[model samples]
Target: MARIIGGLTTSHVPSIGKAIAQKEQESPYWKPFFDAFKPAHEWLAREKPDVAVVIYNDHGLNNFLDKMPTFAIGAAAEYHNADEGWGIPVLKPFRGHPKLSWHIIESLVADEFDITMCQEVLVDHAFTLPMALMYPGNIDWPVATVPVMLNSVQHPLPTARRCYKLGQAIGRAIDSFPEDIKVVLLGTGGLSHQLDGKRAGFINKPFDLWCMDKMRNDPEALARLSNHEIVEKAGSQGVELMTWIAMRAAMTGRVKELHATYHVPISNTGGAVMLFENNPQPHAIAAE
Candidate 1:
């Protein structure tokens, strides 16, 4: 059966990609931020997991406002990067695990999640930036991926409870697969920062830190957070934290946080990277 070795969460700020392209990691402004992911890269290099279940939101790249599914899964054999209106240099196509994706899709539907399955997708910064941070300098990513898209950009987004439940279903699906696969889950986006209006440059360090501590000690406590509170405290884009909740919920028992770093004003966003390993023992809730 497939096993979830761990989970990771990071801010997918587009400016971070720009910093990478400009080779500014050592720069004073970006040094602290880039240095934070060093341990994460080391971990990935050592573990070398076979697959990654990436949970991220689309940033108006492939899916437009005209039609958007709250939850979409990519079942494709490969996915390419998108320009996202700025002509960012496209990376090589990312390989996908169609077999496992299909397995997950079928399982999610059976569990009543009603996820949309995509055969092809042009991933945006939300997907690529985190991969670049996690696996720097690799032309091709080391592991196959299953791209899971959630709607953080749109209102009426999935409730924290719903996101957690969906993740629980995904965890079950991965475990039930017959293959002996080692998997890592990732949730990308959010610390804090408003992107529009007069309050565009907002940053709330205290709130972001509170979220990290709470997520580390008791993720169940986060399920009660309302969207309005998230927006007010974290920022408009902070809704993206829902992805982190999903990543946390997919883990077994309480998670053990391995490494975490938080930096402010990364392109008007509060940036953070958190790495966590799932406890091997099953939680009591799992038996229910």
Candidate 2:
């Protein structure tokens, strides 16, 4: 059976992408950010999962305000690294696992979770930046991917509770698949920072750390947190942490946090990265 080996969470700030593209990872300004993922990259190199189910939000790239789906899954054979208007150097086309994507889509639909199926989609910085961090210095990504796009740009976004439940459904789907595949779940974006209005340069370190600790120790309590509460405490952009919650909730039992990195003031964002491996045995406590 297909098994979920682990999950990851990271802040998807666009500036991080710029830092990587400029090859300034070893420099003082970018060293902390890049150095943080070194362990994760090495771990990934060893684990070598067959597929990555990335949960991220679009930033006005392929998903404009006009026709945004609350949740979308890419079933395309390959995905293009489209220019998100501002001329960020595009990466090579990312190979996709269409069969697994379709299986997830069918499973989600059967479980009553409405999802937009995309046979073709242009992935923006939200998706690519994390990829760059996770697999730096690679010409092509090692594993095929399944993009699970969540709505963080639009209002009426899926709540934290819903995202967690959706993740549970996805975990079940993965377990049911007959292929002997290893899967990784990635929750990309946010540790608290705002990018618009008068509050553009906001960064809440205490709140971000608190949330991270909570997620690591007691994700069930994290699931009970509402979006309004998250926004209020972690700043507006912190809403992106919904993806993190879903990624954590997707795995069974308690998760062992393997490595973590956090830095302040990454282009008006609180940058962070965490890697987690699920325990083989399930926790006896109820998921409140």
Candidate 3:
């Protein structure tokens, strides 16, 4: 049976993509954030998961405010990345696992989650940047992917609890699949920052640190928060933390925080990278 090996959570700010295009990773402004992924790269090298289930929010490349599904999954055989007016260079198409995607779709529907299935989806930077961060300098990606997008951009978004439940359903789906493949979950976006409104350029360091701690120690506390509460504390755009919560929920087993790093003011966002080993033996929480 297929099993989840671990999860990775990181911010997907578009400027990170531009930095990659300009080869600025080691620059003073970018090095702290970029260097944090070294341990994650080492972990991936050691585990070498066969599939990556990326949970992210679409930024108008595929869905718009007029017609956005609360939850969507990519079932296509290949997912292409396009320039979403960010001026970042487009990435090559990522190979997809249709069989696993279909299984997950069917299982989610059966679980009454009402997910939208996309056979052809245009992945924007939110999806691609995290992949690039995980597999740096690779022209071709190493693992097959499944894009699980949440609607963090629109009103009436899925509540934190609902997103957690959706992730639990996804965990069940992956566990029941017959294939003997290893899967890694990638939850992209947010620690805390706001892009617009009167609170524009906001960064809540205390809240970001608190959320990160709860993610590793007591995610249930985070899930209990209402959408309004999250926006009020984390800023409007910071609601993207739902993707991180969902990724944590999908683990469905005792998790270990293998490595984590948090840096502030990355394009007005609180950039964070956390790696978790799912279902670690002897089941004890390690100090973060």
True-structure RMSD, every candidate: 2.3, 3.1, 3.4
Q: Quantify how close model 1 is to the true structure by its C-alpha RMSD in Å.
A: 2.3
lDDT of 3 by residue, 1-288 (tens): 788999899999999988998999999999999998999999999999999999999989999877799999999999999879848889999999999999999999999988899999999898999999999996579999999999988899999999999988998899888998999999999989888899898889999999999999998888999999999988898999999999999997778999989998799999998999997334222421
Candidate 2 lDDT (Cα, whole model)? 0.85
Clashes in model 1: which pairs? none
The predicted structure with the larger lDDT, 2 or 3, is 3
Model 1's number of clashes is: 0
lDDT of 2 by residue, 180-272 (tens): 899988999898977777877778899888878988887777788888888877778889998888888888655798998889867777888
* Candidate 3 weakest lDDT stretch, 10 residues: 279-288
| Residue 187 alpha-carbon offset, candidate 2, angstroms | 0.7
The per-model lDDT (C-alpha) reads: 0.87, 0.85, 0.92
Model 2 C-alpha RMSD to native: 3.1
- Candidate 1 residues 5-121, lDDT tens each? 897899988888788888999999999888888888788878788999999999998788898999999999999996788866677789899999999999999999989899988
Best by lDDT: 3
Off by over 4 Å in 3: 280-288
**Least well predicted 10-residue stretch by lDDT in candidate 2:** 279-288
Clashing pairs in 2: none
Best by TM-score: 3
Model 3 error, position 99 (Å): 0.5
